[model samples]
Target: MNIVDRIWNSSLGKKYLMALTGGALFVFLIGHLVGNLQVFGPPELINGYAHFLKSKPLLLWGARLGLLACVALHIASAVTLAQLNAAARPQPYATPGAYGASKASQYMLPTGIVIASFIVYHLAHFTALLPGVNGVGDFSKLTTTLHGETVPDVYAMMVLGLQVKWVCAFYLVAQALLFMHLSHGLAAMFQSLGFRDHVWWPRIECFAKAASIALLIGYSIIPVAICLKLVGSDYVERKKYDLKAANPQPAPAFVAAQGKEAK
Candidate 1:
C-alpha cells in the first residue's frame, strides 16, 4: 500500500490529527468572530482593525499558512474518518426509516461540510485571495481614518446579499446548519482533546452549545439589521462607544433599593 493509505489506515494517527486540527480551528473561529465583530461598528472601525491585522506582511503570511494547514488537516481527517465510519457500518439500510436519528446525529457532518464550503467562499470574497481584489481599503485617501488603516465593508456585501430574497434564504439555511455543526463539533472537539471527565463533560457541552448559538446570533444580526437598514453608518459610529460601557448607571429599581436600604 502507498504511504498515504498506510497512515490513514492507522486509527490512532487519524484521531490525533483530527483532535489537534479541530482544536486549532475552534480557537481560530472564536478569534475570527471577535475580529469580525468590529464590522458592526463602522466601516472605518472594522477597516482599521482589518488593516492592523495585515500591517505586517510576514505576520499575515504566517497566519495564512497556519490557517491553510488547519484547513488541510481538518478536511483530510474528516474524509478519512467518514470512510472509516462507512466501512465499519458497511450495510445499506433495508428501509429508509429503519434507523432513527436525532437532530444532531442527522446534521453534524453534513452541516459541517456545508459550513466549510461557506468559509472557503467567504475567504475568497472578502480576503485578498482572488486577483483584482485590492487588500482592504484605500487608507491613504481617507480624511480622518480611525486607526490609519482601512478594512473593506464586508458588512455591505452581507447586507446586499441577504437583502435578495434567495440569498437571504440561502444564508438562513446555511446559518441553521452551521449552528448544528457547531453544537456537535464544539462538544466533540473538547472531549477528543482530553477534556473527557464525566464531571466536566455536561458543563462543557452546555458551554459549547451556548457559545455556538451566541456567535451564530451575533453574526446573523449584522446581516439582518443591515438588510433592513436598521443600522446605518451613523448608528454604527455612535454605538461603538455606547456598546462598550462596562459599568453604566444602575437601573431605577437598583437605585431605589439602595436608597431604601440605606435609609
Candidate 2:
C-alpha cells in the first residue's frame, strides 16, 4: 500500500497526524499571543503591526488558511483515532480511571468542540469586525491614521469589544478550557511520537502543564484588562470617533470604481 493509504488505514498514522497538527497549533498559539500582547504597547505600535499584516494579504491569508487546515486535520485525526480506540475496546471498563488517561485527556474531545465554536465566534467578533453587546458602534469603522495611511484601530476595538461583561466571561471560560486541553495534549503529543520515557515522562508532563498555564495567562490578560478599562480610548471623550465608526459612508471615488467594475 502507498504511504497515504497506509496512513489512512492505520491507527498509528492517525496518532502521528494528531501530534503534528497539535504541535503546529501550539506554536501558533505562542505566536498569536506574542502578536496580541503588542496591544500593551502604544497605539502606533500595534496599529503598525496590524497594518503591516493587512498590507501583506498573501502572508496573512497564507498563515490563516494553513492554520485552518491544521485545525481541520487535527480534529479529524483525533475523532478517527477515538473511533478506532472505541472499536478496539467495545467492552467498557467498569471503573473510571482503569485506563491511565489523565483527567484532562478524558476531556480533550468536549473541550475541543467548545473551542471550535469559540473559534467561529472569535472570527466573527474580531476578524469580521462585528459589533456586539460591548456597545461599540461598528467595529469595522474603527480606524486611525499612521504615516498618512488609514488603518483599523485594533487597540481600541479590543478594549471596547471586551468591555461587555458576558463577552469577558465567555473569553475567560474559553481560556480556561484551552488550558485544560493544551495541558494534556502537549504531553500526549510527545508520547504519541515515542518521546515519552520513564525518566522523561514526568518532565514532559510538567513542561506541558507549565506551557498551558503560561498560555492561559497570556490570553486571559487582554480581555480582563479591556473589560476593566485598563486599555483603549476613553468612552466619554471618544464619542465623536465612535460616530465615525458607526456611520462611514463610502467615498464617491470608491463607489464610482465599484460601478465601473460592475458594468
Candidate 3:
C-alpha cells in the first residue's frame, strides 16, 4: 500500500487528520466572527465588504470548496476512529467509569453532529438566500449604497433574519452546542497531536476554555442584538435611505415647468 493509504488506515493518522481539520476550522470561526461583527458598523462598511467578496468569485468559491473538503475529511476520520474504538472494546466496562473522560469529551460526537447540521442550515439561510427559511423576503433584492454604489445589504439581511424570536433562539442553542463541542475538541486535538506534556497540559486546557467562551460570545452577539431590537427595525429604515441616496429621483414637475417657462 502507498504511504498515504497506510497512514490513513492507522489510528494515529485519523487523530492527526481530525486535529489538523479542527484547528483549521477553529481559525476560520475566529475570522468569520470578526467579519460578521462588522454589522455593528455603518451599512456601507458591511455592504462594501460583501461586494468586495462577491467581486472575487474565484477566491470565494475556492475557499468554500476547501472548507467543505476539510469538513468531510474531519467527520469521516472521526467516525472511522470511533467505529474502530467501539469494535476493539466489544465488552462493557465493569466499573462504569468513563475512563477520565470529561462530560464535554463524552458528548463530542453528538455535539459535533448538531454543529454540522447547524452549518448546513446556516449556509442555506444566508449564503443561499432561501426564502422563508431565513425570515427575510427577497434578500437578493435588498440593496444599500456604499460610496455611491448600490450593493447587497448584508447588514439589513442579518437584522431581519435574526429578528425572528425563534430563529434567534435557534442560533443561541446551536452556539451553546458549538461551545460544548469546542471546549473538549480543542484540548483533545492538542493531546492527540502529542502535545500532552504534563507541564503545559493545564495551560492548554485553560486556553481551550477561554477560546471556546470567546467564540460563544462572538457568535451570540448578532442574535442578542436583534432580540433586543438594537439592529432590526432601525436598520431597515436606514437601508431605505441608502437605496434612495444611491438612485436619486428627478426634480418635481412644477419646478421643471417653471424653469421651461422662464427660459
Per-candidate TM-scores read 0.71, 0.87, 0.86
**Could you give candidate 1's per-residue lDDT for residues 85-203 as a string of tens digits?**
77987777776742665577566668778878877756664553341122222211122245453344444443333444554555666777877877877787777667779899999
Ranking of all candidate structures by their lDDT, best first = 3, 2, 1
What C-alpha lDDT does candidate 1 achieve relative to the native structure?
0.63
Of the candidates shown, which would achieve the greatest lDDT relative to the real structure?
3
The TM-score between candidate 2 and the true structure equals 0.87
**Candidate 1: where is the Cα deviation over 4 Å?**
1-9, 93-101, 128-165, 233-263
User: What C-alpha lDDT values do all the predictions have?
Assistant: 0.63, 0.82, 0.83
Clashing pairs in model 2?
none
Cα error, candidate 1, residue 90 (Å)? 2.0
TM-score order of candidates, top first? 2, 3, 1
lDDT of 2: 0.82
**Which of the numbered candidates is closest to the native, going by highest TM-score?**
2
List model 2 lDDT by residue over 11-106, tens digit each: 888888889999999999999999999988887888798898999999999999999999999888878877887798888877775477677888
Clash counts for the predictions, in order: 2, 0, 0
- TM-score preference between candidates 1 and 2, better one: 2
